[model samples]
Target chain A: MASFRSSLPVYATTLDVVWHYAFRTICGAILVFLVAPILVIIPLSFNAESFFSFTSGMVSLKPEAYSLKWYRDIFTNGMGAPEAAFGWSWLVDSWRHGQWMLALRNSVVVGVASTLVATALGTLASVGLSRPEMPFRGLIMGLLISPMIVPIIITATGLFFFFSSVGLAQTYLGLILAHALLGTPFVVITVTATLTSFDRSLMRAAANLGASPLRAFFSVQAPLILPGVISGALFAFVTSFDEVVVVLFLAEPDQRTIPRQMWSGLREQVSPTILAVATILVLISLAMLGSLEMLRRRVERLKTETPI
Target chain B: MTAVELGTEGLERRLARAERRGKLRAFLLVAPLLAFVLLSFAMPILTLVRQAAYNTLVSANLPETTALIADWKVDAPVPEPLCEALVREMHAAKEVDPAIPSRIATFVNRERAGSLSRVKQVANADIKAPYCAGLAALHDDWAQPDIWRALKIVAPSFSPRFFLQALDFRLQADGSIRSQDSNEALHLMLFRRTLLVAAGVTLACALLGFPVAYLLAHVSLRVSNMLLIIVLLPFWTSLLVRTTAWIALLQQNGVVNDTLVALHIIGEKGRLEMMYNMFATLVVMTHVLLPFMILPLFSVMKGINPNFTRAALSLGATPSTAFWKVYFPQTIPGLGAGCLLVFILAVGYYITPALVGGQSGQLISNIIAFHMQKTLNWPLAAAIGTILLAGVLLLYWLYSRLVGIDKMKLG
Candidate 1:
């Protein structure tokens, strides 16, 4: 009987070991599944062939034989290249010569302008909402933030009609306004969280020292809130840049953002140029993400060192 | 004794003055935002919702006729005499504006078509008055099944037909809520598809994010914060760029397949179905949404003391058991909050799936978009949108109930 009881535990222990190994293996495998597609797409962006699949030479282990011809084709326009092998020579030439650059520039311009505008408006709104002295405070904040909760499709539709009525439809100004409106909520949320940690007493101290309210704000308050504002601005910029639905309703073809351009290209044409564009985008995002990380760390450092 | 020191009149007067100044300043500070929201957001939505129920074209053009049939019930085909009245009113409608026929045609076509097409044409032709006489003289077939179909579709009075259609239900000829079959269907497959896709994406985010967040919280703060930003960086760039970047990396000839082939992980003959598939959709969506999950989990995890695990361990529990029983349960609120927010966001997402999902991968929002932009079915689109809004709100309510949202800590 003692042996039977002891043997049962040994069996259970073996089962437990198997279970642990299986669970870890499965979870890690899933993590790979999660991370692989993202990592895999990097090399596919380098394929020399026009087809989405690999050719014999492209997949070979030897790095020496692999050509940067696809990258080159993506960067420069050569008129004399034979059309015999691949169907996308014109696309290759166009992409190489810098037409995509214009689209990229337009996207950046729109993203930047909208972000700046949203951050400014959102900051003012957040400040007003934060003040205890402001009346109907709850109601006003709710109203201001309602835009975020509403369906973007509905917002897009409303913007379409509203802009069309004012003749701002299809204009860059219209797209900017639409993006700004949508992007403002993120700024408000981020800045409000930052403002919560703010010491109202610090402002009073500056005032007691005979600093005017404006000076107190600029000298003392602004520096403390600057990190929040910057984070909010970056969020807004990214929000505007990545937005597609509202842009689809509001932007003309000429005003196509990179997303809008990618959307059209995906729907109308399937090409490696898109892949090239995606790779560049990934690189830019990684760099931006890295910088944002640095900013966040700096903020954390400030929080710990300054006690307030 | 001290209370008696101040003069009552002086204190009251001072209070009144302060109140007046406070009120004025509040107005000054608060007015623009109220005006902005009222004018820019609230007014537009009110107008859109109003249009969704009853559009201006129907009210202004057929006010008299609508008033005549205002009490018409759904027991039978719109009264035959009402149809005649509509035919006459439509004639007058054309005189007011040539666009009435097309407008009315939209409503009528939803029901019977062939019979109603002639009625629309007659209405467009401006054949007014002694309308039965006009109808007889015209000898047009306005009593056929198609005409009734068209007329019924365009019929007035704050009908719930559009709303029903939006939910993928249609008001049958019998006026019952019935499942739409192939022949007479208004499929909300896309909306449901959007919801399903959104759920799947949210699940993926949580599944991947929970472990990473657990690692960050339990591990050293330095490493945790580093991974946190790595998680947040995509959030800083425009989502458009990140999504596009995924496309490049995932495309057939894209980096992933190239690497795999080079490493001989998979044979070179077959290409990975990297882009424009469910795998691509989930991959890009999860990448976009991972930060949302991580941030909330991190904040909640930060608040949880390490002692709970140690206490459990001291009680002779295994480390994994201690962690799961004591630590994981406390993080549920964050998990719920993160999942709700990400799922809600994903449900409404259009761009990522549209670009990466290909034809088979398209979700419901894409259809709603098509209806809004391409088909110009404003009422129908509004109906669909209203349903989507309701679905999101309902899900949020369920989440709040399940998770006790007030307790969820956020970054």
Candidate 2:
């Protein structure tokens, strides 16, 4: 019964013990592979030097080896008169002139705009698709979701040709529409999932109690399925916020978004400012992941409390 | 009529009417998004495919030259009419738009490099009639037959030459198709590498994901939930953040090399070249895509009844035998779904490869981007995209068939 491998049973052969340990090692390595690259840059983003690598000072955990310079550079890089005293005017200057700030505003505007459009449409379609009476459900779902599955390059190429021909290329509206198209599937899937689990008898009960279809929906269906709608919107936001290829094809110099900015930063130059931005993005995603987990548990609780 | 009096047929008709009305209401709900997708998403893709077959680059700007060279022999001396058309087109190009000549220059310049200055010089010159003689007088390069041939190739509003170029085949002057000569294998090589990388990533994902997924599926609920977060957190993370992290970790003066040096495992001079090579591409991509492989496989593995494997273990079968013969077969659907999803994704991958995959790691998508942005060869770019799109959609179709896409999940 003496054993180094806790998971292996006493009757297991020597080969079983070896295989069991080896399996654990492989799984451990794979987990590390998944998580390490993401965690490795957190410390590096705070590097005192402009270099992407660690310094001896950093390795030795010297207090002076960490700095917030790159984080400041995100605001100061393209700001006019960045050396001016910090004030409301500095905030205004950053809003107007800072390159990364402009990209941040553009990303937020585009992400919110696209998420709103895609979520509205996707939720509506999902409602229809979830209806038992819906026709050609498979084919329509395929068409709606095809954008997510298609290689982004093909979509970008097509958009370049189509948008340029239609005079929509390089416009903010065009980029929003492109992102909305890409984000639609996520919204559709998530919202549809919540709707599929929704109990129909509650709607029937509301109707039986003299509630109008619209009123019943707003009161009964809306509250119960709200988590899916919100999660789907979040998904759409993240999809648009992280997207760059279509933006690269469609956006003009001024219409740059965060991902587009990071793309150029990575390609034209590998600067630590990008690492700083990435660190912020990682924090945002972590927050989103936490909220999604909570929403998921909420949905599960609601499901269990509801009758069949 | 009362149901008892109406009988079966009437009842059936009434039910059908109610069903149709429900269907109408449902269709109305979806109609707006359907129209939007059809007009925007589907139409743009169609436009992209159309570009590969028909383009207006030459026919729009070089109308006169295109008309004049419609029937010109490639091997023969430059005709007077063709020269006059070129002169007239160049002369009128300024009035139409000053950039037209350069556009034409770029269109033909790609075919034969030196033809740009010849086109520009003739456009700038105030040469009088005896236009053919004037063209010859302007420069000896202008007298070349190859310039005329370049015009012939690009002149048409409709041509399959782009697709030909994409496939590493060229249309000869005599209207024959032939393979591009040696060293012109750039397109073919890219196609090969795209598929190879996709396949390799799929295989690597399978190897790495299988154990992790199995462990998640088999473990206690509390342990599995904790491990699942470790898997899903990365999925929620931004892709560029992750790629940058890899660069920081793998770069020569980065943490990994520094650690190796500190440990005396390798000398400072012996630091490995990892970032911007195929090694980085495969490793980074495998890391990025591992979650995709694991999630679907884990979902499938979770559904499997443990007793089936336990029964096999209790029987004559050894642990490995039980795994291979009984347990593995049941995970095929999940494995198939994960593999196809990863392969489809990997095939069209751009961001990871572009960032990590240096020159040796560049895929067809990068080349396509180059043509679209830098080279400005829209037709050829469209052709390559069409090829890549076709492959991806085929695998997607296979995925839908093998594992219904509705069954696809996200965490």
Candidate 3:
């Protein structure tokens, strides 16, 4: 195929090559445009000065021009005594008083709690949904996934009234349930996709071998689909971690997550600390993307290697 | 009957029972999630929609007053009995909760602004015998028939007042609806602008995403996969971070302007105001939502048999003709899916526009947030939410019809 493509017909001319180059160039530029803004913040986050733009010293590659001040400020900004000697007490003070630290704690707690709920519920539902015997599957699936399709504002407003009435508003549990609802759709989609190619006969084979249905699922299905489940959980975690709209309406001051904190920071005050946060978030996303990619490749490999 | 027939009948019955149990087991597995979603997700939205058309704020607090006012003629003077009921309810409510009268006043003021203080003044006034005269003495505006008419309109326990208001209409005392005055007709215009912006963003995504998707689809798998990661990076990035990046690049003293100034594209003093406006919203949204468009298009385009275009060209059709007739026609499903997805997402965009969208750029979502948080007007917020939800569901239905919801994928 490569040789056939290289030995083009006489009709294939320089104009075709030029058009191909132009198309590739446009695509490359668009990709750069997509990734550039994300990369732009990294250097700006490290700037010794608080400005968004690069200083001449930084452009000239002066080692003195860059500092970790903003990154340090992520922890030390709200500390009682930044000038205090580095010790456990200073760390404790930062943990207690730092805005970003509080947000980080809230984000992890909410993200993990929501991801757990979403993954459990979503995985079970996908198992049932993928079953041929499931009833009202289309309508039920649509309703289950509508959280992703519905506008966050509507969901938030609805949740605000409902949660306020139920005494869930401004509470950690309320935010957890709300984030879980939003994250479930991703879990459902990813897991469902994995199950589409899944062979059902393996379960029957295990059952014939005297394994109970639950045991069969654990031994036969779960191991094979573990990559999908983990990826789905990761997606759920990301959804909850990055979520802000619902949190804006539902969370109290103490429950503010990283994205929620960044929202207020960007809106009320534009600070280099937010850029530092953004850079950190970018790194987190990079890690997530890397893992998702690995899981996807593993799933593909598993699908091919295993037979019914 | 033979013994063999009896055994076969028993076996068939047992098999039927097992099948039923299997179905039940499957349903039971899904039931918990369905129930959780129903309580947490569906019920709240239903409550919001219901609240839009149902408010008991006035009727609940001022029950006797509301009842008495309902019997009065629209153009008639404030009846003496109605004034007595009002005074009775105010004193009674004041004893129960000090904020009740003020809450009722605020509720009434929603129908007719500036009536709260007038109502408050009456509630505060010391009254002698013949309470109507004393009420009129407390506030001169009390004697006007329109104030009384406004009270009657909002006095209903179940009212379409918020929904009407959301639609840019006012409910009159005569049980008729009329268009709101020009100054108050904000929602309809906002809804129109929201649709326009969503449509514009969809078009922009399609225009920009098509080439990239085409390149990804036609390239070697190794190259495409590498490029796909670049596209997915922003898709996975935090929305706030992306919006902040836009702010850094687009703000007056940000990188873009600085670069332009150094290159002498424009004078340093004439740095463009580019951050907070409709243009910025569109540009940034297109950037943020482009991946949504690209991914779907790429998936579909990748599935297209390249042989069709080759065959068309071999049949002596021009390359453009082959693309237009053969390749482009096949990509319509992807186009439809991508456009609908982008438009639906754009319609509900809150954070991006909130950060970058200034006055003119603001969508209906922003206004909904404003009412929910700022104005403390829950009914109006609910009403706006209901309309936005209706629009989204309609588009969603169309999308599911065009591209099955089950087929939707995320990175």
Best candidate, DockQ: 3
**Which has the greatest TM-score?**
3
Off by over 4 Å in 3: A1-10, B1-16
- Candidate 1 segments exceeding 4 Å error: A1-36, A53-56, A61-99, A133-143, A149-151, B1-38, B69-92, B115-117, B123-130, B133-140, B145-149, B172-181, B184-192, B234-284, B358-360, B394-411
For model 2, the stretches where C-alpha displacement exceeds 4 angstroms are: A1-10, A13-15, A81-86, B1-10, B60-68, B73-94, B120-144
Q: How close is every model to the real structure, measured as TM-score? A: 0.82, 0.94, 0.97
Question: TM-score of predicted model 2?
Answer: 0.94
DockQ list for all candidates? 0.27, 0.76, 0.83
Global lDDT of each model?
0.69, 0.89, 0.90
Candidate ranking (lDDT, best to worst) = 3, 2, 1
lDDT of 2 by residue, B1-411 (tens): 777877887889999999999999999989989998997899999999998998786777668778878878777777888788888777787678888788888777867777888877878898878998888899877777887787788788888888999999987655778898778669999999989999999999999999999999988998998899899878988888888889889989888988899999999899999999999999988988999999999999999998998999888788779999999999999999999999998989998989989999898899999899887888899999998898888888888888986887787
Judge candidate 2 against the unseen true structure and give its global Cα lDDT, from 0 to 1.
Answer: 0.89
How much of the true A–B contact set does each candidate keep? Answer: 0.30, 0.73, 0.81
- Candidate 3's displacement at residue B231, Å, is 0.8
State the lDDT of candidate 1 residue by residue for B1-411, as single tens digits. 366556776799899898878666546644654565576667666656665677556656777656655555444435556656777678788888887777776666655544445656667554555564556556546433345443444556567777877766767643577665566454466766777788888988898888767766765777666655556555554565566567656777666677787889988887698789877887788888877887888788889988888799789998679878898899997898899889877877777777788877777666677778787777777777666766766766665567543333223
- What fraction of the reference structure's interface contacts does model 3 contain? 0.81
Q: Model 3, range B1-411, lDDT digits (tens) per residue? A: 999999999999999998888788888988988999999999999999988888776788788888888888887678888988887778777778888778878877877888998877656777775888887788877778777887898788788888888889999897899999998899999999999999999998999899999989877899899999999999999999999999999998899998898889999799998989998999899999999999999999999999999999999999999999999999999998999999999999998889999887899999999998899998999998998999899999888888998889986
How badly does each model clash, as a count of residue pairs? 37, 0, 0
lDDT of 2 by residue, A160-234 (tens): 899999999999999999999999999888888899899888889999999998999899998998999999999
Interface RMSD for each of the candidates: 3.9, 1.0, 0.8
